[model samples]
Target: MTSGTADSGRVRSGLRGAAWLLPAAIVLVALNFRGPIVAPAPVIGDIRADLGMTATVAGLLTTIPVLCFALATPFASWVIARFTAERAVSLSLVIVLVGTVVRSIPHEAALLIGTAVIGIGITIGNVVIPVVIRRDTSPERVGLVTGVYTSALNIGSMTTSLGTAPIAAAWGWPIAIAVWGVLALIAAAAWTYTVGAGAAWRGSDHDSEPLPVTGPIDQVLDTGSVRTATEQRAAVIETLPHPAKRWVTWGLMLAFGGQAFSYYALTAWIPTLLHDEIGFDTASSGASSSVFQILAVVGALGVPVLANRFRPRVIIVLVAFFWLAMPLGLLIAPQLWLLWSVLGGAAQGGGITIIFIVIVRLVSNDDDARRMSAFVQGGGYLLGSAGPLVAGALHGATGGWTAPLLTVLVAVLLLGVVGSVSARKVR
Candidate 1:
């Protein structure tokens, strides 16, 4: 056969191979995003004693990462634009690996600095994964893959939260927190292998541009026309409204902020709330909180199934109801903590999934996807990073769970209102 025919065969082979491997790689990477942040929480007292830090400083271990999620988003967007999504993922994993090792070094300064580095690394992953999902997955499968991706995030959080304190007991908190880096290293190697294999088959070195199905060979073979087409597309995008100016974008940002605020606040203090309000012991309270984290997987997976049958607005309303029920249920009937936790868990998980789905559906292309994801997540996390602190402060001031639960209820109300407005059909 001719050279053109041979090249086509190689491209097709690469596509088929990537179809399965890509999603697996995405899931693996997802598993690392939240695990590292939550790992230190279960062993915070040990960590504080070991490092000689006060409670406020120790709290930064988790807070720093959420702040980084907001602060580093613009930088994350730039990295994706500079390097391809595949290379960005590899770089993020490497950064996470290095940060994990640094945090395990048994020094207070190292622990704090290392936590910041991990946050920065995870920020990059947060921005890119959605872009990769939007670019690689077929239109029909985007919702399914997004759900799986979000669900994996919860699984990681649940795994680390439930497992860390025991591991710390056996081997020390440093080792307990550091062990998660192994997963990041494995994911990096797997992702790097896929990128290399695809590059070899496609026979290209430039990773700056998104290629059509046939790959970068087309650009190499027809540089002038490809450049013109790219320029034209950019010009068209320029003519449209900026992402910042769009009402839907702002609505989604608020929706995400409310979701993040509720999730982080609850994750940080649900055990304490249960102990104080429901009279559960320390161990029981901790175990009960796990119910909230683990049930998120169900919520994440359920959103896609609901999407198949209902309009986006209907799903948003339903999720909002669940979110509203959690705070109200906790305030009115603390006896049913289990039931409220399950509903709240599902609401948080489904809330994030639906926002992601709306983002991917609303954007016109990969560049738009990157920018929009960064904008929404950056704003959302900035608001979210305040959740735990605010909840703690309210509890301290009022000396009751009632005030904090009311605060959470207000945030959920914002979520329902803005989420409904955001989900309205775009004309």
Candidate 2:
């Protein structure tokens, strides 16, 4: 009787410890979410001027981080499975801190290397946050937590995008990059304090599964189950939602991919685009891009609220119809269309938020959601990663911006089709 009591007490204490670490780790990871990617965008020109580089190289710099996003997600599933979600996320933040510090070095080589590392950190955070939420929180609250997480991610992104440029303008670019490290370190400290030294706690009502961390080697050798191993590998590549889900997944991916491509191009080069095309100064461009991002947050916030009140598909279709005009407006009416661009971005972000919210609710279990998340993002970002670079490359290759603009026009139309498909009522 005493032995059993002691074991129960130890288990109870462990769960208590995990409860604190779990949420703290989540919020900390969320803090670093957009720090690596968008924060550096505003400083692109500074780096270019310093290095005497071309626009193509600039595109490569942004492309590298996104490519990491595409690549890192597959590894994330393995990461959470092996180390567990909290540990995987905690370790990713460490990478973010280290990456930020490294980028702060005055050398161009380190900047590239550090940026990629920071992206790797963000990638893990992106993939695991959903899984952790499903595992730890109650079913009813999943949608709410998804919104909160999305909000946290956007908040981090907006801060980084807005903060980095001004800092780089005042201090050296290295200092600007390094400044974000403080947040990462603070996140790490908060996480460690909350969880103490061990993994997150498991409650009695929970069916405690292993966290989502596993490397390829672990998959091939450690698991030793050919069936589960094959499924894991496939999970990263294809989402393969059922008949009802098929169009929805493709539509979300396309709509997401389309706007994402455009947004990346716009945010990365809006200042340059306006400067080269119209005559706006850098400050004006930055302010405009910041406004666009802020509106995106508004759209993201509207997703759950609107979702609860309306059919998810109807909301999606409305957003899609609105988004169709963004690229067209940019091409035909630069003066009138910049506002359209901003509104389009917000619509896309909102659509994405609801897509994820539905995903949070629709899947049957935590593991399924994790697999679905990895597959959707992996494939989605594969398309998404290509958009910005292609736009930049088109401008470089053709010696004109018109081709890039035209490409966005085509992409915008296609994305609408996808969004329409994604708006279906199937679970």
Top candidate on TM-score is 1
Model 1: number of clashes? 0
Q: Rate the local accuracy (lDDT) of all candidates.
A: 0.81, 0.67
Question: For model 2, how does the per-residue alpha-carbon lDDT over 123-190 read when each residue is reduced to its tens digit?
Answer: 78777777777656655555566666666666676677677777877887778778888888888888
Candidate 1 RMSD computed on C-alpha atoms after optimal superposition onto the true structure = 4.7
Query: TM-score for every candidate vs. truth?
Result: 0.88, 0.79
lDDT of 2 at 307: 75
Error of 2 at 152 (Å): 2.6
Deviating ranges (above 4 Å) for candidate 2: 1-28, 193-255
Q: Alpha-carbon error at 303 in model 2, in Å? A: 0.5
Model 1, CA-based lDDT: 0.81
